[model samples]
Target: MGGPDSLTKDTAHDVASHRIASVEGENGGGKEDAKDNALQALSTFLRDDMEACNREIVARMQSPVPLIPQLGAHLVAAGGKRLRPLLTLAAARLCGYEPSPERQRHVGLAACVEFIHTATLLHDDVVDESTLRRGLASANAVFGNKASVLVGDFLFARSFQLMTADGSLKVMAILSAASATIAEGEVLQMATQNDLSTPIERYLEVIHGKTAALFAAACRVGAVVAGRPEAEEAALEAYGTNLGMAFQLVDDALDYAADQQVLGKTVGDDMREGKITLPVLAAYQAGNEEDRAFWLRVIETGEQHDEDLPHALDLIARTGAIQTTLERAQSYARAAMQALDIFPESEIRQLLMDAASYTVSRVN
Candidate 1:
């Protein structure tokens, strides 16, 4: 919209690097050194790319629909970590799209990822009937659910329009499949809501569909757009999936473990809404009869009070649900790092790998 100075490539890279940590080799001397090298290189490139992405988002989102501009601004200005677009950039780099003219094109794709993500938030707020988002009034809350839903649909259409403009049939395929998966995931979640009989396996399945699917798509699209080899494409896909899974696990855990201020959302929101997540599944699996009944009552009958929070948390904590969820997240993060092996040893690869580590453990 404006000049790159508004976003400032220098600023965007700094934000992207925080999402991950490097894997250490057993030797301690070689792996960390290599990872540091990669991190430095990747950090330099990401700042410029993220800045460009931010600028494009600002300019490209101009719309005829009044609600699109208003609601889109609220979500974009919320200042998220921009993880989806960052992954696209990382995958492109891994796929051999370097610092050249083609790189700028990659920035557009990155913006697409962020736009699609933001659009999802608009829709999710309506579906969840959420009053808040990104530490502010949710679009559905301030703009009304009808407007929010309509605007969300508009954004979705706009995202597809952008993809078609890019003229990549493959890109369209990747995005289309991801969109379908996301819708199916939402439906799966809807089916499970308020249903205490839901199993742990089903919960993870829903998480993959709703959350990780797009993450995988972001990375896959980047690699494909950049004309990377199949191995590299697979690598980016795996990386996105693992990173996505880790994020959801941590997100679920945060609902129980984090401060409302730090989380930028209300405490126990999922529990209050009866959306059973991984931690809840783990807790239920590990709980006793009495503990199980307590959770069942609070979740199904909406009988919860603040006083029940501690007991519920204790039950979750005592059963090692928090640790269990964290461990699951870590497993995915590890898988993400392993997928990066196809790419030759590079500073950027290390940063991407490290990013996987950081995503699961980031407090904020």
Candidate 2:
């Protein structure tokens, strides 16, 4: 896998540590506490059900081939917050779906959402040639790409099986469309990857495909399982779509603005990979001829050097690229919160709203 230059492991580690210290000092208390509290509230609300979802994940990952289970488990056990699955469960409960042997099927459906997300991550690491995931070596980095890809396929297959087992054609249709959309989004991102001229519209399209589509699908499934009316279904989907957009925008900005530890990845990984995220697009479009030339050389031509990162960061900061990106994220977060208004007031509704704000707070 001959990719463009990337930071050495040691360099990224040191840079991340320094960024964490700086963020800790600058961000003192407020939003950080809110973010943690919101996530904790959601997690506490769904703890028992999430445990059941985990058990379902483990049961479904079984294959006669031990390597398949091992690789799948490795990725699954990695430190993701399981936000998508949580959305499914919470959305269902918010719709007043009562717990029963029948209602418990939501757990399996939530597990299916996790499998889809995990499969995508596995394939994404292969596509990106990524070495680290969730602060540890990626499965592809340790087990080899062939194993990762095949195991990812297995997971995708497993998810479809789980979807079918739930016996809801509505659920099946929503998740299947999302799966295809996610693939299309990955390919779209590939097409736009190194092109500095990639427009903001195209960038948003890519993220909607890659990130938000599944989020919408996940939440929509919850309402479906609850036998909620189509209006409620649309509301949850809207909530998820906006939340997903906000989440990705924050993520794109954090890749440039966050400390390595806080971000759980290298600061300039997107730039190094020539991925044209919002911040890069913002700075490039805002710059004069000289800045455009710099972007052309580094992003388009992949001629980045050590000094180029600082220069890029300087350009982004001076152009208020991160600030503008985060502002867009906040707008989406607000929209996400607004989407929940049609639902009755409940602790779950407030937590979901808080969850939207928490998604963008990393960049705040």
Candidate 3:
């Protein structure tokens, strides 16, 4: 289990085939090449906002109080790729938000998205009793749970205030609904913790409600706020939903497949926490009776330990659970690309497509 991740003989064949397809995809010309090139150029647009917004984030979080300095500084400094905020900017630009023509409304909106996301993370760590985030002690670990929760609330209120400045009822409605939905998802996840009997449908529902909804809503807010056409707005929302699902799927995969160093969390951590993810679903469907018994005794009994990792990985492999789960992730990514047909050929649009592909297929 501590060795390099290697597929069993049967799955190795699938990997071989997948490798060929990947090589072809990577080297493909015309559309694919252009997509890659466009995505490369996106750094120019996202880099400034990513850095400036991050700096401003620290500045904005500063309060005259003592606790605020320690806690807020830790949170604002935590390394995140800031994809949600980046998505907002991309949508704004696509909708034709010109810095000169109409002012950079995108900056405020993107910041709002990030604020809400960070607030949620702060609270989620407390709920999960998580010790680590982004390969470091979680805010709750450093600041203590009470401070984390209260500070999270402060951020939520601040995000609400920022959203109001956007001056769009539509944007406000979308984000407000998203925030409420996320809260519901937290409750749903809590209700189902360590529930090995949780059906695949229920698992999908929880992920959709908890994770994908916000991505969809956030992208929708961005596109709609920038005054994109209805069809393009819908397309972007679909893009976000698909991308979010793919991202979560990969996250779930890495929880089982990746090293603690690469993943910023321990492998099998999800299983230890009794979180029933896609691989678990695949294992349940494909496992033998004894394998099922093993899962039930460990996961259902809420007694899974670090030692249970091998059995879990073996069972998943025996059942080809990992393979099936990865396939599902790819399916979602492909569906996302289909949604992009609404947009005309543009560097940004194609780059979005490439980025979506990369999100689902990441190794860690």
Q: In TM-score terms, which candidate is top?
A: 2
- What TM-score, over all chains together, does every model reach? 0.86, 0.89, 0.85
Model 1 stretches astray by more than 4 angstroms: 1-44, 99-103
Would you list the rank order by TM-score, best first? 2, 1, 3
180: Cα error in model 3, Å: 0.9
Clashing residue pairs in all predictions, respectively, total 9, 0, 0
The sequence of per-residue lDDT tens digits that candidate 2 reaches over residues 1-364 is 1111233334333333444334333333444454565765676667667666766776677766766656654555455677899899999999988878755868989999999999999999999999888777888887889988988999999999999899988899999999999999999999998898788999999999999999999999999988999999999999999999999999999888887876677789999999999999999999999999999999999998999998999999999999999999999999999999999889889989989988887532
The CA lDDT at 151 in model 1 is 72
**Total clashes for model 2:** 0
What is the alpha-carbon RMSD of candidate 2 to the true structure? 7.5
Models, CA RMSD each: 7.0, 7.5, 10.8
> Which candidate's lDDT is highest?
2
Q: Cα lDDT of all candidates, in order?
A: 0.76, 0.84, 0.72
Q: Give per-residue lDDT, candidate 2, residue 22.
A: 42
> How many angstroms is residue 315 displaced in model 1 relative to the true structure, after the best TM-score fit?
1.5
